[model samples]
Target: MNPVAVSIEDRVLALITEDELVSLTEALVAAGGENPGGTEEATVAVLEAFCLGAGLETLAEEAAPGRPNLTAVLRGGDRPGLLFLGHSDVVPAGEGWDRPPFEPYVRDGRLFGRGATDMKGGLAAVAVALKALKAAGVDLPGDITLACTVDEEDLGIGIRAYTRAHLGERFSGCVVAEPTDLGTVVGCRGDSYIDVTVHGRSAHSGRPADGLNAIDAAARIIALVREDHERLQQDQDALLGAGSWNVGLIEGGTGTSMVAGECRLSLDRRLMPDDNAARILESLRERIAEAGLERDGFAVSAAVTMEMPGFRTPEDHPLVADAVAALSDCGVASGIGGWTAACDGGFIARDFGVPTIVMGPGGLNDQAHQVNESVSIAELVAAARAYALLCLRHSSPA
Candidate 1:
């Protein structure tokens, strides 16, 4: 490692102060008001407010009427840039909590709130690290881009639009600040959402035999999918493991005394490198055919609603080596591993073809999306140091 690079890393770690981290967290929790996924207008408003307060240039892209995604840039020297990606939206705060969902609370050295562990904590930590680096007069050799987008908990329209309209060929690498238990995540499984609809005739329940039931056809289709899931496990790929399928939602008959006229099943499929949307649709069609549901009376149609492909950076990639060395300087010992859950890293890696990694504070099973979701301050501080070190190691002049 270069001496100057090591020195920069050490300085960044030292500069990540406790007050800075606390302020960032406070701003995040204050801004991340009530509302989850689809209803994140207030949250976006708070994020924009925080950005303006920090004197950072804020750019908002309207994904919908009131829903907007935010992007802010922390200027640095001329070099290859790094993007810090995070999502402002979080899952719904279900029942059972000591405090309200929107009201941020700190207790027992941990921050308790809805978005604390799943993502907001990580985002706050990144903000604090950048603030410290700027204050310390350490001119980064590269730029730091911070993007906190909406619709990550439901649909990723924010990232999709951003990548399509902007950032087409700008960034060098990206780090999705998702909760990875302070571990480095190098790759993730691909994901696709499909809606399968089966059509049949409707008749009076008294004469059920007079009409073909779409519900029964849907049942057959579900069975075929279960079998397909097993086969997918057998044909698992090396990096992504087994391609799995889950029937998320099913809708059928309307009236209690009527035979079902239509049935629609929503499927969530985790794909491997070898699997694509078209191939998965074809497989579903083949399964329907094998189940003898290809006739006119029983028709099956598939529509792909969303897709995010899996991605991996080679172990020898420069970005990977740099990240590992930075973590080692922070006294962390570990190698990168695959993540079971998907994030915007898929978009960065697959769409932009950028070397992306998912790394941050908090554990994987800290009751994310639960009533009492929380993140330890120690973990938050450690993550801030790690991210600061990462910037130093990657941005120092050679």
Candidate 2:
């Protein structure tokens, strides 16, 4: 086993395997940090131990009371390093599971469990990739850093904290190890939440005309939102297409006997890089104002509650070419693709001006957050090899 005698690529390919990937993924799934009520502490602990054992310098920081973000570094050179980003928190496993969601198991070649696809599987691939790179004895000119954070499935507090804290540090590039089915995503649509509240006077059913109706105002706003969504289709990008909207939640009417005093609408907006959330909100507010809902003390107010910017990297960027090449070399044939789903990578790309791409092992639309959430064993191994290759190639220029 002469390190100098063997090629780095060969060594990395040999070291990463489906068994190892599964072992790590199963452990991560078993840790069970479902986002709504649960915390990422258990998942962070698992990642910390793995990072330490793989000879990486691990740093764990509490994002919230029990939620944590882990940054593990494979130290390389003086220059900015490559960032491999992921999240530890997963969406809560709701009803409709064939078995317990957190109990990881393999069936037919797929690892099934909550977060296995969206994305403890991706987490394991990231860890395995870093481990293989280290075990292969590759001397990266730039460091390869793995940052697994919390709250990606929720409001994105984990990534925001990481970006704010590392404002002083820079990176050559960022690879977000999200479930991208081993495809490299150059453009991804971002997400945002907006809430519209209407306040009015409640009155008895017999005297409804005497009071302002908030539910009436809310219905008008919903129609307006539909129109706005239609207007957005005209402004489209080649990669990400058009931004869209959905009224995901609505709360109104206290009882059938009284006119509703208040109504609230929670909106989900998918954004492209060109769409400015503030401007969109302002425009929406203007339109709502014109609706004249505030006659006799009924008024509607809307504001953006959460936002993650979307990014589109030019297909000609070196980062895109490099990622495609790495996956191709690993026998995962994929090219530059677009992700309609949003991810934390947008924060890194928009805020830090880093070249970022989302790539990993599972299917986004089908597997992630589904009842039988699962990821292919072979895909996980390929993702690891591709990630290792990307790290090696990324560090070469620096």
Candidate 3:
């Protein structure tokens, strides 16, 4: 409904070419960049090449080889700056695909490939936006920093290292180009991975009564944790909703013949702003104790294997308002929502306290990480323009 948004949207649409968009998508998939922590050389190479092609100066950290995180700065006039964050790494291509997962294919106007909807499409859109900005000769009011990081799928080690070591106190605000179905993602749930180990006694199968079953103890603990999570659901927030937990993995028993002496369970807990990693762990420990399994026959211990805190920007925050205005200017409706999934935005928001938003092309149920995962070309073009307008608006003075 905003007239300014319509103009910006038209400009963005005018700049994105179908051939160019297709080529970028094809190139990214062809690069065959897989693995987290950015160790995949092919992914790093593709990102570097794309940045250079877009006429941006790219820098990579030397501490980790093959796994490189890149940043490029586009300078405008004196105004508050904006940082665009993304990752080049895609999750491993699991089995079963209509076509080869790495080989890009277009059908029904949608580009199908691994990482198509999850992120590579978003990356390509940013590239196209940068190219459009240069071609349009639009005088930027401030600077724009585009950072393509590594290892968002596994842990955010790549971006974390880069931010801590290099980009300390550099930008005013940031936007993580995560897939949000072209809607404004104002917040998301925080996540922590905990490893739980239960100990029991191993005995010969002939005398099963002499030994305890670690698997049984773990199952009881899991049930108690699930029940506690359901209780936590009553405390949901309007944006982030209630925190939750899941027992992602459980392993026990050395072999079928012997009673299992030890079992391990990996818990994936999503936290709300009211919760922290330590608090979540304590709650789990309490639940285990309540299950009456705290004796010598059963043991429980937890360690935070990974942690990514959640954050949100006030609806009226300058960064949030500016981004909404820009998206509106680009002919898109401006609304806010929360993402259940985690991204590097957590690191950016938690570590730097920057007002960060997640906005990108593609739908929420595009079958990401599934066979025939794909993104529509129309969405890609629209996303490119949105990114360009956001860069222009944020890089401009108030």
Top model number, TM-score = 2
TM-score each candidate.
Answer: 0.92, 0.96, 0.90
For candidate 2, write residues 282-377 as lDDT tens digits: 988888878877654777788898999998787888888888988898788886789888999898898878888888999898999899899999
The alpha-carbon lDDT assigned to residue 185 of candidate 1 equals 80
- Off by more than 4 A, model 3: 1-14, 36-39, 62-65, 77-79, 290-292, 395-398
Candidate that beats the other on TM-score, 2 or 3, i.e. the better one: 2
**What is the lDDT, from 0 to 100, of the residue 81 in candidate 2?**
78
Given candidate 2, what's the lDDT at residue 153? 88
lDDT per residue for candidate 3 within 283-362, as digits (tens), equals 77887887788774677777888888887777777777777776775677867888777777877887776788888876
Candidate 3 yields a Cα-based lDDT of 0.78
Q: Rank order by TM-score, top first?
A: 2, 1, 3
In terms of lDDT, model 2 sits at 0.87
Query: Using lDDT as the measure, what is the rank order of every candidate, best first?
Result: 2, 3, 1
Question: For model 1, where is the 10-residue window of minimal lDDT?
Answer: 30-39
True lDDT of residue 290, candidate 3: 73
lDDT, candidate 1, at 67 = 76
